[model samples]
Target chain A: MISEEEVKHIAKLARLGLTDKEVGKFQKELSSILDYFEKLKKIDVSDVEPSSRSFAAENVLRRDEIKEEQSKRNRKLLELAPETKDGYLKVKPIIKFS
Target chain B: MEIKELTIKQAHDGLKKKEFSAAELCKSYLDRISKKNREIFSFLEISEDLAMNQAKEVDEMISSKKEMPLLAGIPCGIKDNMLVEGLKCTAASKILKNYTAPYDATVTKKLKAQNALILGKTNLDEFAMGASTEHSAFGPTKNPNDLSRVPGGSSGGSAAAVAADLSIFALGSDTGGSIRQPSSFCGTVGLKPTYGAVSPYGLIAFASSLDQIGPITKTVEDCKMVFDAIKGKDELDSTSVELSKIAQAKYDLRNVRIGVPKEYFVKGIDPEVEKIIKSAIKKYEDNGVKIEEVSLPHTEYALPCYYIIAPSEASANLARYDGIKYGMSNAGSPASKLLDVYLSTREEGFGPEVRRRIMLGTYALSSGYYDAYYLKAQKVRTRVIDDFNKVFKKVDALFTPVSPILPFKIGEKIEDPLSMYLVDIYTVSVNLAGLPALSMPCGKAGKLPVGLQIIGKRFEEDKILEIGKLYEHF
Candidate 1:
């Protein structure tokens, strides 16, 4: 079962702040989801190759010609932003890694 | 012409007969949006000027002795994830709420080339992360059928927009059944084209390999029309393929072999859903189409494989939203380093479910768990595709229920992420297998709609469409 502490840990890794109530709630919910996944474990995939992409596409390449025109429109996009400072849109400071 | 309820084909015919102009059709849809969308919350931004201007150009072309394009005069609802030049393309998140795309997605350019009028971008779960649109920073989109219930999600607004007649058709990205599940709930036809059948350029990535843009419309024919206009090779989109230029299918279904996997009809599937799907399968039998019981034995493992693989990709894809260049910046915060800024911004910007997945994804991709989880899931994914390939050798298509249950009440599954994940059980396998699948309303369970899914071989969307159209008639 997914415990309250485990839920809180997952939330912390997710960088979310949750109350005791939310931790308890997600603990129960995530535990049930894990239980449900247990049903999938019953299936035998011993011989199956794990699939990431369903299509058979591989190593697709494009003409790497630098399209200088679209980059020129980048400034036009900044001009449309609701708020900007020092040529960049300004906002509240996010978390900084020490 | 009260062109609000007219099909794309009908609208095209009306434009040709001079009974109504493309501008007139655009105006009617705009008026309808003003009246209906207040309750539906389908469209995020309606471009009155862009739509009318394009409509006027299409009308002028008709008068100037030029041939009308297939989607000419048709107005479509675009999911907010797609970039539309000059429109604020927020993925329904506050982080990029005010951000506008400077250029169009390749699909958007193709639609513009066909003279289609874009109504507006519709709402979605923040960054297309959640199955229920409740994660959207804007607000939850109520199901069009019953406002008390959810319209089945991240693409809920797109499906609801078409269901509520706000637009003729909508384009939605399906990563693990976002488009098809919502279409099933909303009682519209939704298609998840084969991976790379349509270009993904300018589509804000949720999970790059899993994200596929497809059509949600009132009928299969409308879907085929829009698919033709949008599906083609684009130099800008590396994954896109030049799917058969023969856009329309001339093949008949009488000789096609159809499969119904006994495994998908497993226990816990709601009885009402099973009844509806079985009834749909019966229609093919009545048509001279051969039916066989095929086994996608690896079907049950799809959900666990998806949760691991999708979140792993999501964790990597969402790394670009650091507060440094774009989105919400937290520079002045007490946290001193660059990583703190990145974490705090994402913490504040993303909703709970998105965070949960990101964390789950980060865990799966972390050093210790990579082989145990991510690599293992990839191996299982290969098995799922192999299972499909084996089954397809016996049948042209596989029929199944879109979701095990009908649309739940609005708050029913919100507190339970597992329940929400369970909603995509039948759908996750299609994405895992990378096959084309369509969901059409087969019946109603009490008040909500029941969707019958037709799964076709990779790139054989025409067969799925033919079978889906037949089921619609059924």
Candidate 2:
């Protein structure tokens, strides 16, 4: 079973603030789930190469020319932001002045 | 004629013949949505005005004596995860509760270009994560067949919408059986096209590598029509591929070979569902089609492997909802740091199942555990792929039951996430291997429907659809 600290660490990495009840619940759930995933350890994958994609995908390239329609789309996207000023999305301060 | 029971072909023919106007057909569906949507919860938002205006355009075209596309007058549902350009695309999550799509998804664009009337956006599990729509932040979509049971999901709303005749058809994305499993429960025809067969541009990303958008319809023929309209390469999506370059072999029933994977028929499957699937295979054999028992030994590991890989990708995809750009944000308070904004927004915004998956994925991809979990699952994924590769060489298509059980009760397995994940055991391997598969109603396990899954090789949608068509007639 995974420890509660590990679950806490994972939540921190995922940037999620969990209530104490949720932390306890996830601790039990994630432990059981990880135990189920332990079965994969028995398989012999020494000779096999890991594959992330189901099919081969070649890189697709295109010209980087900007279009008038894209700027219109940008304006629409900016409108969705909760806080915007001068056509820029506003967010909480990133730097701390201690 | 009962407008509710009209298939795509019937609707198209009726429109061309002027038996009824597109506006009339559109209103009939809107009327049905008004009457039934409250109980089933199939649609999250109804685009009544947009649908009416599109119907008017089709009516105008008919009057002008212009040729019409097959989907020209068809009113359909877009799964809420795909963007529809100005429509609400919530992905059935609180995070995107007020989020309106600013662009059209490639499939939506394709459907719009064909003049297919958009009825509204259907519901799904938050970020298409759960096997049932119970994870939907709004509410669960009840099965039309049995009000107490769940319509399988995260494509539950799309399947239920089609099954309840709320929409002529609907589009759904499959990542680990999201489309086919729900179609099985709702008794609608659904296809999960080969990876890259349809463009994923504008689809709310789930597991990027495993994600595929396909159709849910009343019949295989309608599924084919929708697939044809939305499929093919797009410049916006790099993974999208043109299927025309690959030559398809015409299948003859008498000479075709069908394999029943032995692993899928084992314990845990409801006996009635098994019996129905076996009988469906018997009908194929009765038709002079060769039936053989095949073994895909890696089948048992598919669900576990999928749990790892899908979550790993989902973690990365979901990281974008950090309260800065569009979506529900919790950053308005004084002295709120950027990190605190991410934490509080996500904590308040995402549903439980979505949070569980994101956490699971984050842990799996994190340092020290990455090679043990994610890498190992990917290698097993290769074995799953190889199993399909070896079996397809011996058979034209493989047949299995879409799910082990019937449409389960709404709250039965929601608390037990593992059991919910187990629901996709028989369907996830196809996604892992990037193969085309379809779920068609084979027979009934009592009043509940059983679906026969027909899986084909990569880019072999034509072959499987033909096989499904053959069984559909029988």
Candidate 3:
């Protein structure tokens, strides 16, 4: 079973601030789910190669030229941001001024 | 006109004959949505203005005596996870509640090119995580056939909308049975096209490797029309490929070989659902089609394998929702630090199931657990793919029940996440192998509909559609 500390650690890793109640709920739920997932260990995969995708695909490259319409679309996207200034998205202060 | 009984083809014919103007048809659907949508909650946002404007364009084209596409003026719904420029695309999550789409999804662009009327966006699970739409932050979409039961999900609203005739056709995305399972429960025809068949650009990322956008319609022919319109290579999505590049073979319906995996018909399935599926296959045999019992031994491991691979991919894909770019943000609250902003915004934005999945994914991909869980799951996935490859050598397609049970009650399995995951047992293997599969209503178990799943080889949508058409006539 997953412990309370482990639950809190996972929530932090996922960048979700869970309440005390949610922590307890996830502790039980995650433990039960992980127990269910233990079924995978029974399969012998020693000789198998891991597959990340169902189909094999090659990398596709395109020209690096910029299009005028894309810049206009980028402006519209910036407008969706909560805070923006001078055609750029504004965010919380990263460096402290102490 | 009875709007509920109209199919896409019928609507096209009616428009061509001037039996009804495109605006008239669009208004009919908008009126129906306004009246019935409140009860089922299938639509999250109704785009009445957009629908009317598109319909007017179709009318202008017709009056000008210009040739029109089959989808011209046919009103449809897009699953909320896909973007429709300038429309509210919340993805049924509070995080995106106020988020308006900045651009059109590739599928939306294709449909717009054909002049298909955009009725609105439908609801889905938050971030397309859960099997039932009950996890939708907006509210659950009840089954049209039986309001007390669930219309299966993450595509629940799309399937329910089509089943309720709120829209003639709708687009849905499938990741580990999101499309096919819900289509089974709702009694609508749904197709999960081969992965990379349709471009994924503009779709809200869930599990990038497994996610596929498909069509949910009232009939197989309508499903095919929508598939043809939205499929092909796109520069925006590198994985996208042209269907013509794949070789195609012609097969007479009578000479086709179909395999029924013995693993799917085992004990946990409802006896009534099994009986219905078996009878449907018997009908094909009666028509001189060859039916064989095949073994896909790794079928049982698919769900466990999917749980790992999908969540691992989802963890990386969803990491972009860090409260900086767009959507909801808590930038300068009690704590003005960037980390604090991410924590507070996500805590308030995500729903319970979404949080649970995000945590599960993060844990699986974290240090010390990667090789054991994620790597092991991917290896099992290779076995699952190998099983399909070996079986396809002997059969043209495979037939199975879409779900083990019928449309379950609304609150039946929501409390138990494991039980909810079991609902996808019969459908996830197809997605794991990146194959095309169709879900069509075969018969009924009591009042609930049972769907027969026709699964085809990778890029063999034509074969499955042909097989689905044969069953439609029977």
Output the number of the DockQ-best candidate.
2
Q: Give lDDT: candidate 3, residue B85.
A: 97
Q: Give the higher-TM-score candidate: 1 or 3.
A: 3
**For residues B1-474, could you state the per-residue lDDT of candidate 1 as single tens digits?**
577667788878988999988888999999999998889898889998999999999999999969999898899999999999989898998778877788999889999999999999999998888777888889888898999899998899999999998999999999999999999999999999998789999999988878899999998999899888889788877888888653653565778788889888988798988988897788778877788888887777888889888988988887777665665666567777655776667767777777677767866676676776788888888888888888877777888899998787888887778778878889998888778899988888777898888898778887788788886675
Ranking by lDDT: 2, 3, 1
lDDT of 1 at B121: 93
Q: Which of 1 and 3 is ahead in lDDT?
A: 3
* lDDT of each candidate versus the true structure: 0.83, 0.93, 0.92
Candidate 1 local distance difference test against the native: 0.83
Off by over 4 Å in 3: none
Cα distance off (Å), candidate 1, residue B201? 0.5
Estimate the Cα RMSD of every predicted model relative to the unseen true structure: 3.3, 1.1, 1.1
Per-residue lDDT over B322-437 for candidate 2, one digit per residue giving the tens place of the 0 to 100 score: 88898998877563578889999999999999999999999999999999999989999999999999998999999999999999998999999999998999998998999999
DockQ of each two-chain model = 0.37, 0.83, 0.83
Q: Which ten residues in a row have the lowest lDDT in candidate 2 chain B?
A: B329-338
- Candidate 3 lDDT at B327 equals 88
> Among all windows of ten consecutive residues in candidate 2 chain A, which has the lowest summed lDDT?
A88-97
